[model samples]
Target chain A: MTPEILSPAFGLVFDPYVLWVVAGSALFGLFVGAIPGLSATMATALLVPATFFMPPIPAIASMVTATAMAIFAGDIPSCLLRMPGTPASAAYTDEAYALTKKGQGELSLGAGLVFSVIGGLFGTFILILCAPLLAEFALRFSSFEYFWLTLLGLSCAVFIASGDKLKGVISLLIGLLVATVGLDNPAGHPRFTFGLPELMGGAELIPIMVGMFAVSEVMRSSISVAAPLETAQTAIGNVFRGMWGLLKKYPLQTLRGSVLGTLVGALPGAGADIAAWMSYAMSKKFSKEPEKFGTGHIEGIVESGAANNSALAGAWIPAMVFGIPGDSITAIVIGVLYMKNLNPGPTLFVNNAASVYAVFLLFILANLLMLPFGWAAIKSFKQVLRLPRKALLPCILVFCILGAFAINNSVVGIAMMLAFGILAWLMEENGIPVAPAILGMVLGTLLEEHFITSMIKSDGNPLAFFDRPIAGTLAATMIALIVIPTLARLLVRKRPA
Target chain B: MKIGDTVLGALFALLGAIVLWHVRTFPVIPGQKFGAALFPGVIAAGLVVCGILLSVRGLRQADGGGRTIAFDEWARDPVVVVRFLSVPAGLLFYILTSNFLGFHIAASVAMLGWLLVFGVRLLPAVALAICFPALMHLAFYKLLRVPLPWGLLEKVVFPS
Candidate 1:
């Protein structure tokens, strides 16, 4: 926060190389996010191999810029074709499409663009103000506290993030098991290498992520590859019109969405999609015209659009301070953070203070860049949609091949990608949520490391986990999160009977 | 494939049993009870319990069709099935052949197969299949220095 550190951070982010990376990533993100089935997480996963060659700041810059633009650009397809480009857009898709049907498409698209920028900037402000303070507090934590925090995060993934709780647990266990496939444990006992040298180094995160997010999505898209994409509105005109009036009309809703979105985004496991969904519901619940929600109303769009984009920045809070991902996108990011030797934790903030400020600066720049870039994306909606899925999907598959291969520069990476791709496709087919599994994969080793360290420190006493004050509170919260919902459900069932 | 919860649960439970049994022989930390096996052991046990719960829940549901496996509507269409299967088939083709055929040849053939199977016009499919890999070569091989294998084209590409 000092002027000295701030100046260097500004220098880092404003470099010509970093700006070029940011600009290139913004366009790449918009293209990927505007296309249906190419999720924001997939954009991050596919960008990993490219970032592998980049310096830490540019690598971080590319992902930050791409994801911010991608989230906003996702609004384009939802508004035009009624097909949400990413799950975050799914919440307000019907409302946006309804606006298009009612000839208020520009209004809907305008609110999405405007509110998203507002929310993103708002979230970045919070990040700048809060991350350093949290990092300072986090410095006092012991392994016990970290263990509870990681467990709390994993619990949130299962309880709050997924629809089917049982399936979510299963998916998470699968990821944790996969994470145990190396000789890097405390005892250095090769548990699951199966005599392979590559396995001893552990299952690579980049390849597995590409498989889970990108390859599985491609597989799902392949089934409906022949379905024609038809746009409801052929041309968009002046999406900025009426935006100011709407902002004046719904200032409260905009602030509420951004606030709630940031809070939810900060929570582990829950991300932009969940934030958008919850904020949209809250908007309808609080609005004077609740009945106008589904029928082309711009109010819900104003709130949730801002909410989703703000949630993007919100998710970064825990990621930077605790090394725990707030969403699947950040889950992929945590891996990159580790690869760049900028390991996430309180130590990161202390040691690489300049890098931390650079990230904050990048968030602000990316959000500001969204207005013009999103405008152009909406204006050229027809050309974006004209790329046939048949042609585009194969190209993506090739890209996936290269992305996976580039990680290890070996066919083994592609092999892992293929295997996990099929596994992920099957998991999704059976209603298992993949986000928890990914979070598990990202946090599993760290969780184990902390657990073992705490156990040894406490001489193998199970109750020592709650010995620390912060650890006890986190443990209590985790327990309540798991127990309260089930108890409520049971009580409701009994009353109904 | 839409597998019934009962079958999926049983598979997971069986897998957990295997993991637990296999981890039994792993030596513990000297003079300490817990070791490398402890974490995976707990996870395997959780998998077993969750699997059983899932199976019971699946059995209690009326919509499970009393079958271990079922095909969704898309799976019933043979053409759709081919398209669906082509994705993995294409990736597998690249994996088995990439090092031998080199990245360029292997990727082009795989891309061509996917494009054709997904019903792109032959002309455009052929064009994309060739051009996309070359573009990738410039990005990955030349620019990024990914060291993509050249296979039969190595002699022509490098002229070493």
Candidate 2:
């Protein structure tokens, strides 16, 4: 808030080392995020070891640049091949792919890039203004509040389901079951290790994620391998061509997505993926032409693309302020912050005020860098899609394998990818939704942790969950989210169509 | 294969039952009212309810006598199945052979085999098969400091 603090932070962030790191990480994120099997989370995981060597400002800048670029780059594959590069992209992959198939590939790619920038910048502005206040609010939250918050985030799963609510619930339960497999469970006993030492650590998320989204895509592609590869547009020319026009027409959707994404991102457990899903669902729910959502509409893409990137910045609000991670990426960032001796919390703002400003400056710089970097990335996507499916699919397979193995430096991760890949393929082929299952996996552990800890704190008194004011409000909202929708549906059915 | 909701529901129910039964045996943490099984138990029960709902839907559709089992578009062709199975085979091949043949050789073979199986020409497949894994090896092993098992490459690339 002071010029003295801002002056030193400006010096720290503008250093040559930090700029280079941001540039390098932006490219790294683009490559990893554009690849079908790789994701933004994986980008950060791979960057962690390298970040350990850098100073705090450059270390955090690299992450900020990479994740922002990665989330946007994810849309490139989604638009081009119908394969989302990350789970966040999965929220709008169908919508983007639909546009590509409609011969509006350039528009699809542009919406993703432009809205991502708008959303990212918007989230940063909000973070700059609200982080200190939000952190103060978050600090008062106990396990009971967190339990409700996580539950509210988990409620997004039902909204995320594309079809068959029953199937969605089944898929979510499956994911929750997978989360219970490790020894880190509240009881301290591994529930489903099957006596294997590797299993005792529970499942690594990257493999499960890659398996469900990427490997399953591979399997799906393999079945149709003999079919001739057809593209909606053979060449992508000037992906930024129609972007300005689209932006002019849909300014409000962009704002709505950014706002929703930031709020969701500030929630402890929800991340960009949830933000995108929620935004997409919200876009559809409020759209005048909801029926056109899956048929290549750019409206949802504009919204969710904005969402996922903005959510990336929104996540930092909690991570920088309270040390409580807003998502998995920030969870890693929190560790990096601690390692750099910039321990998060309100004290850090006072004790290391300059460094906090350094982080903020890095965020602004990273979002600004996305313009050129994302432009180059869109151009590159066209070139990559030109490869024959036969050649390209194998290349993707190699990336998937390498990415899975690199995560834990173990073959067990690869095995998990294989097993879940087939399982996901079967589920998809059968009418079950895979996205909810993934959300369940991501939130399941947090849900359990919060629930158990709150129970322990409340000494198993069910009423104690509602003892706190925030907890009470959250519980009421969660109930309303479920009940109001059902009641409305019943009322609608009672009336004539 | 294209399966109906009935079978899918049964499978879900079966999975739920197995989870519920298995979690019952989990050691309850001493002096804690809720144990490790609490969350999983809740999930399993939810799965059971979903399975029941799915079964009811399936039964109603079946009673209409208009439903029929269907093969997916890909399943109608034997070659497609070959292409589909080749992916898993290629993955399993890499897992088994990566250490013995080395990451480079095994990955190249897997890539080459997958391309050929998927009907890529021999020359292009061979070229990509050899080139791709080397690039990956450099990035992961040399740059990232990940110790990718070299196997046969160890003797040549890192000889004593």
- Highest TM-score against the true fold, candidate: 1
Tell me the deviation in Å of residue A128 in model 1: 1.4
Q: Which candidate should be chosen as best, given DockQ against the real structure?
A: 1
Candidate 2 regions exceeding 4 Å error are A1-21, A24-116, A159-163, A223-363, A377-382, A495-497, B62-70, B152-160
lDDT of 1 by residue, A342-454 (tens): 99999999899999999999999999999999898888878878888989899888999999988878898999999999999999989998888988888899899999899
Which clashing pairs does model 2 show? none
Give all TM-scores, in the order shown: 0.98, 0.79
lDDT by residue for model 2 (B33-94), tens: 88888888889988888887887788788454213466777776788888888888899988
lDDT of every model, 2 decimals: 0.92, 0.81
Task: Tell me how far the alpha carbon of residue A175 in candidate 2 is from the true structure, in angstroms, after superposition.
Answer: 1.7
lDDT of 2 by residue, A33-105 (tens): 8866567876775676566557888889988999999999999888887878888999999888888888888
Under CAPRI classification, how is model 2 graded?
medium
